[model samples]
Target: MAVKDAAKDEDDDNEVSAEPTPPLPTPATPPPSPTQEHIPSSPQAQTAQP
Candidate 1:
């Protein structure tokens, strides 16, 4: 009976001494780019001919 109790105590100590598992790191994501066309000519830039 004493030996059984000693083994149980040793098992409990081992369980307490075991290290915890670490969490996994999250993955990184890339940013989106803008896509727009620019018009260089304005209404004043146009000329009328007779």
Candidate 2:
């Protein structure tokens, strides 16, 4: 019974060690730059209304 228990523990350890970790998800596209030149100015900038 002790031998069987030891074998079972070894098997469990092997299973835990052999698992393939899932790869981290990748972004579909690169993030936009914070200081990009093409960003439009706010509406407040174009109007004089207070």
Candidate 3:
């Protein structure tokens, strides 16, 4: 019984280590995105006005 418990505990440890961690929340908007967003909107607005 003691050996069985130890084996189970070892398996639990291995599972804990092997389990993949959930992905962290990443910024959906990247840094260069702000400049890209602005660049396109400016031209679209200019065309709309003229």
> Which candidate leads the pack in lDDT?
3
Clash statistics: count for each candidate: 0, 0, 0
> What's the candidate order when arranged by decreasing lDDT?
3, 2, 1
Note the Cα lDDT for every prediction shown.
0.45, 0.55, 0.76
Task: Estimate, for each residue in 1-50, the C-alpha lDDT of model 1 and write its tens digit.
Answer: 99999999998887766533122121211111111111223333453221
lDDT-better candidate, 1 vs 2:
2
> In candidate 1, which residue pairs clash?
none
For model 3 the TM-score comes to 0.37
Ranking by TM-score: 2, 3, 1
The best candidate by TM-score is 2
Q: Give candidate 2's whole-model lDDT.
A: 0.55
lDDT minimum window of 10 residues, candidate 1: 29-38
